[model samples]
Target chain A: MEVTASIEKERKTNLWGGGTSPLKASYGKIMMWFFLLSDAFTFSGLLITYGFLRYSYPAFSGPVSAFKPSVDYWPIPEKIFDAVPFLHGVHLPLLFVGIMTFILILSSVTMVLAVEAGQRMDRKDVTKWMLWTIVGGLAFLGCQAWEWSHFITGTEEGMALSNGVIIHGANLQVNEYGPPLFASLFFFITGFHGTHVASGVLLNVIIFYNVVVGTYDKRGHYEMVEKVGLYWHFVDLVWVFVFTFFYLI
Target chain B: MEQVVAVEVKPVDKKKVKKLWKIALILGVVTLIEFVMAFTLPRGYLLYAGFIGLTIVKAFYIVSEFMHLKHEAKALIWSIMLPTIFVIWLIVALLAEGGSILNALY
Candidate 1:
């Protein structure tokens, strides 16, 4: 009776002492959460840096129709990001980015659905949803590539630098946009995000392969899918903020 | 004597699947609203605040429902969220510095 009492006390008091899952989560899952948290910090750092630079610039204040890129002020986002795929010379204004946002959100949904199917140990369902998720990710990446290409290939009438040198498109050194920093930040932030999406698609493919081979079935759990889903959702979450800060604001 | 262990497979829950789609719909509508406001509303502090507020709303749904962070242990949730406070702090501090620099330059 005394030993039983002591065992109960130990269980309550030594929950995190050792050899116990105090958080009621598997070790792998807890580690994944921490990794995500660190990644969140990295992204926040980059975005906050963007905010700082943006604050330092005087915003362009004029009618959109009359707006022109200059070194003196920050260019309006809508005026700059107005092009759409195959709709050359037409001013669409954030339409392509809005579509990219939709694609990322849809991919996030498919990833969560894959996680749900994994909970049920339904391999077929997991495979289907994972494939869809990969496709959505690929689509987003393709859209980003197109957007980058457009930014690199500037408008027909390029902006003249203060030194009187006309630059057509954006490179590391010069751009037709307002401030050269604008193009630099745009490349860094979106390029970083695009890299994440690419890696996420690769991870999804690996997990999908494992699901096909029934590795999880032998292991008797779909926790791997859950881990990768956490990562996939994180990529989507970061894009949500990037969309707001980069495109909307 | 021989013993056999059978893996348990639960039936798919239709309600859960429906809820996931419901969350997706909410996200889609929120993005659409953002796009509408971007063109309709004039650029100013109010517009910026509105955009940020809507963004947080979308983030809550994604993290809580899609990422399943809402159902996790309180300790885990707190651990993740508490560090994000520093990120908020950094934004305020750095933006202030940037504003000062702009004032000095102009």
Candidate 2:
């Protein structure tokens, strides 16, 4: 009877995270998780809608065929993003986007290392990893900046009309690169992700500053790294979907 | 049921970290496979299925090992994953609506 009673007490006590939380995270981290969950739903909704639209439309032709300008058909992603930097007129399909994807994935790795160092409270290691994370974030933003500019400038030098609709050279409505909807969805999705990466960069910079000055050390914990780590990983998670939907599918 | 066995895992050591690296390497290989399938294959359910499957594997590793959610309490882990179901639901609903709209327009 005493053993049963003791077991029941232990169970009750252990019900609400009684066993762990070495970092002593606060309510902010939980709220961030909740926020990320909602944001993820929004992105998934957008991408799946893209999927449905692509499928419901008429299918693509062969590699040599130019995409006819219309809302009734979707563009092929690889053929659209084939332009490589400095190798202008070179048709290396999906190479630039592949590089961008790798950069983001590597940033995610650095963020994980930063989180590990935070757990161990190694100030030097934390600083090093956090700086690498920041650099990766900056590099991604730079790539996005270049991509956006290339998208805006386009390949042609004048307005083009397709089916009686006026579209700027390589604008969202139509493009020298691919179909109209391709440019439209490209800007919307990648723009949103770029905003997230930009914010994440700023956040990491702030945290790096704090770490340099021993802010978390003075507070007796380094949960801030854990919080930002969650955010960084969430951004990476979104990119996984974007990379699949935008570049691959 | 005679509940006589409770497995207590020893605290994580260098060996466990090495094991995690192996798992991560496998996940990376799976991601490369996804890339190949996406690029080489035609647009169809096969490509979509492969992409989503590989994506789930990648997420599993990031959450379990990188985020350290696996070592957390069951309640915490479930709480984290529970929200993803709603995301999936949202995707399904939006996809259906988008499909119907495109169908009508086309």
Candidate 3:
């Protein structure tokens, strides 16, 4: 009877603090969720404040003189973000960001698959999927880097700031990509998202190694994937807002 | 019977697995639609509405499907979602206050 009682106690303890359930989620998973929630609030604050700023500003009248395109007010998003790589001078609005969004979303899907595989005790499959997730993440990060550099570097014609600083006029009263606020929000929002993606990639890499070495198998569960999935999906979720607020609105 | 139970392992829930994938596909499609709309639509509140609508839809799908809150007990779902609602409310209030500030500055 004593032996049976001891076994039951061990099982109960294992059930808690060892996997994703009953408020006993593994420390990493719980922390990831908490981090995401806090991050969500921060992004929300930025976006809402953006809405207010845009609202209070003078209605965007056509090109702010000299740099004439058409439309008016904030630079049409299509015109500003339209440049695609390699095919320079060709205007393709939102294509790169659209592609980046797809990559991130796909990575989120792959993360879920890894978690699912872990639950099923398929270590090989989990490893494979996790590796793909990592690749997807890195690709997304690369795309973001390209986007940021493009934003920071001025066009060949040269962009002059109101203060006479010849830099990327992508911000500072703007030639394209909307208002200074638009570029400002774009950097802040996407910068934060990029940071999350980078961290997520690192986290996945660690878990991938753990899987390959049989840590999960030894421990008897794959809740790490689920926790990471929560984070990845949160990142994807945030992008939807960024895309809307920055790109559409 | 006792011997048989000792030898048998708990089965992975296949039905639950199928449901998860189905929901994920739905989310992907919604996101794809949002991307298309973003490209084609004119800039304005209409576009903003579409983007926000799609985002909320995507969020619903993730929380329901990926997070498994849909399958969890009502109390658990509430605990997770209620706080999220409060956050949303706070954002709305802040946005309103910020608008007033902007007006004052203008």
Candidate 4:
């Protein structure tokens, strides 16, 4: 009884005492932030690896019209990502990717709105916003699937390899784009990000269900929504850099 | 018997909701600018720098406003952001090494 009293006194006196959260956040929220920081490092490592490999190859020079896909140099991104869905055969560079970016940003906005609703303990608004966010995520994923298929199917006139092999689309072995490394990195980086989005959508669904079932209403707080919102925003953050490095640069 | 805790649900803050939409509008406008620049600006370091700058701007908004980091404690913000400096160092070191390798190969 004496020890318990002494510890309680220490907790009251000391900010660093074990009883208090010095960071002004719950344990779960702190852990979530650290997890996101580490995940950011992982993504940075991948993107930096891409930068290293990209710089190792000679950049394609001259006009875009004069550019051709070869193992010789890096391919122009505009030429490679020129195709748009449904508008087939027409050259619309970066249009699809722009749409994808907008969808992600819109979803992020909806997620923040859900978090705001969660703060007010407004279950109805939370449900509505989460559903919209989920739809946005699904739409983005569908767009990615179409893009991957388009890339894998190759163009009508595929590029010829140095060894006289005429390859159509892209694989780990060879791609009709430019350097084989380009396709490899594209698949790995974007695939990893897409997997994150897929899981994010799954998480959103779970959270949405919980919201509908009044789980947070029982828990006395909606901190779970805020945690997931952090993750979803991080995904969008990474995509911003990816879009710049992979496409714009 | 189940223990029931009463949670105080405050009225919705119109200012907060308006701020979120305002940020969203900013993001959309910046993205539109990027798209327009992609076609008009000649591909070079200038364009790349602009894109990177804008991307950083967008990331700042997302992290600060959407993630609520701005409202978080200062210690939490520092702990999360300070480590990312290492990533910048890694980028510089690796890119230099890549440049050297390129020169050696050629």
Candidate 5:
């Protein structure tokens, strides 16, 4: 037993005890993992808070024939987000946001492709993919701006409670939707996520510049591209969760 | 004597491109499925559960393929994933507490 134990100890030491890359991963990348983990906690807090608030309220029932927002219940997601751009009065729920999701995901694909090209030391391919990714990110940002503005300028007429509390469109205090907390959470969560996308765009721009200037080529590897690819993929991942929690649900 | 570098001009990997297109198609199809389900399914826990399940499936594909986490060292993947248990914990705790609060207040 002693001999077997020593051999096992030796093997484990050789694998992990030496001054080497932890799990064969770099410091910065591992740090990125930790950062993503913490960010995940932050998002969890926000989403759980949303769940708590949503649980506190009753959701609307019946078909469109009898639907109306009141203090009695929560507004159904489809009912609230049914407007389409340039087609006023069109009742297409969640369609535009779905398009936004696909765009972000397309950008993620480009990012990974850029990293893959960087792995192959294909400078031109990296540049092309990175540029496409930047465009995707920028397009997503634009769509978000439009969505936010539409949400702010809500189309549905708000119900005025008999207590003389008049709720119009969504402000920080109240909305045409069920409760004030609903719009507040929507703005906070989506705005926080939009900030992430915006920063991601800025990072992509910087990396795109570096790729064009042949910086990674001189360094003999595209670890930076790989790093950014991880972040871009993470942004897509978060959106997947958000889409489900907010839109699809 | 100077060293002469032999630069190999190679084509892009067709297989890699094919793989990327495959992933993109799969994600799109899944989203379409969710869309169909959203409108058709009666509002209840069943619809909610299905949507969350589909979302998780798409998430798995994105993280494993696009992030290349599956190809990374096993230890690395664990380090990143294990912390997610805390998120689950957060969900359970907050949901239960919120429900209790609602019960107590009303």
Candidate 6:
């Protein structure tokens, strides 16, 4: 009854208030949503192009695969990202990436907790959970660093082609695992996703500082925390797709 | 200047935290399932289809729960949803055009 009464009073005040927000969400929040939606499309286009190119790669026969992997087939994802971190030379095959995925999702959980705490105006809990979220994001980036280096250094073998051309490791021109095109796509897609994570981390740092300095407290709302949380979660969401399309599939 | 009055904040709910943790568990488990299936499933359409299906499930959970899109206004939700149809169009169009390009090369 009390909540309903407050809401009714708010409606009365809102009706008289000029420049009302859409669906009662502030202009900032709605603008963030719009930015995220456009970003989602950019990622979608890249991923879809990846799918189409990968699907047609084997059958294209445009003098491309003639110089790529032997037997005219796309390199299996498992064969490429099989190296585990710190073990020097071991075949883990999705295990490291699996752990990375877990880390990202766990970070998303912490992000939610931070936002939840902010909603309750619990500054201490918000700071704590936001710290955890930052740690998780950094940990995932560290794993990516290891993974990328491994891909670059390669191992004892590079996938030999039909024309006696052996490409070693990954560069703009070639990769040991498969064709140069595959390597380019791998670097571009994962690199783009990693960039988002990096920016999300940076944003979180700023928000965390604001939370500490009582910016949100002064404003009497933690909506900024929630907005940044949305972006953090979206970064995790994009990684989910990248994991499936780039690593698993 | 307007008078500044302190607002009383409500206590945080324990149930909300529990719900968030539960969703996290589900996401982790689904990802683990994908990892396991990667090794066992024979390389074929079935494996690809299963992975894609599980991926969609994870995406739905993350967007609706963690991102709180589920509780948003219907009009706001529809605005996002309707434009996503273009993503589908993009995929179909690219694959079909790519297939023809490959066929021409063949």
- Best-fitting candidate, scored by DockQ: 4
lDDT per model vs. reference: 0.91, 0.74, 0.72, 0.91, 0.85, 0.85
- Give residue A188's error in model 3 in angstroms: 1.9
Note the clash tally of each candidate: 0, 0, 3, 0, 0, 0
- TM-score-wise, the better of 1 and 4 is 1
Give Cα distance to truth, residue A240, candidate 2, Å. Answer: 0.5
- Which of the two candidates, 3 or 4, achieves a greater DockQ against the reference? 4
Q: Compose the digit string of candidate 4's lDDT tens values, residues A1-249.
A: 999999899998997768687789988999999999999999999999998988888888887678888888888888899888889899898989999999999999999999999999988899999999999999999999999999999998999887887999898988999888999999999999999999999999999999998889998788999999999999999998898889888
Q: What CAPRI class is candidate 1? A: medium
Report the lDDT tens digits of candidate 6 across residue range A1-249: 999898778877876454444455777777888898999999999999898887666632334223334435567777667778677677677788888999999999999999999988888899999999999999999999888887887777676767787666887876777667888898899999999999999999999999887888889999999999999999999999999998887
lDDT of 4 by residue, B38-72 (tens): 88988888988899899999999999999999989
Cα lDDT tens digits for candidate 1, A57-168: 8877787678999978888888899999999999899999999999999999999999999999888889999999999999999999999998999988898876887889
Instruction: Give me candidate 5's TM-score against the actual structure.
Output: 0.92
> What are the per-residue Cα lDDT tens digits for candidate 5 across A57-114?
6557677547777766777887788777898888898899999999998998889889
The reply for model 2, stretches above 4 Å from the true place, is A1-25, A61-72, A157-160, A163-168, A172-179, B1-28
Q: Per-residue CA lDDT of candidate 6, range B36-57, in tens?
A: 8987766677998999999999
Can you give the lDDT of residue A125 in candidate 4? 91
What DockQ class does candidate 4 belong to?
Answer: medium
Chain B TM-score of candidate 2 stands at: 0.78
User: Residue A19 of candidate 1: its Cα lDDT?
Assistant: 53
CAPRI-wise, candidate 5 is: medium
Stretches off by above 4 angstroms in model 6 are A1-22, A59-71, A161-165, B1-9
Positional deviation of residue A46's Cα in model 5 after best superposition, in angstroms: 0.9
Write model 3 residue lDDT over A18-112, tens digit each, in one string: 43366534567656666766777787777777766666554455442333332124455555776667978776778888888788777877787
Q: How accurate is candidate 6 locally (lDDT)?
A: 0.85
lDDT of 5 at B84: 92
Give residue A121's error in model 4 in angstroms: 0.5
Off by over 4 Å in 4: A1-14, A17-19, B1-9
Best by TM-score: 1
What are the RMSD figures for all models against the true structure? 2.5, 8.1, 6.9, 2.8, 3.7, 5.6
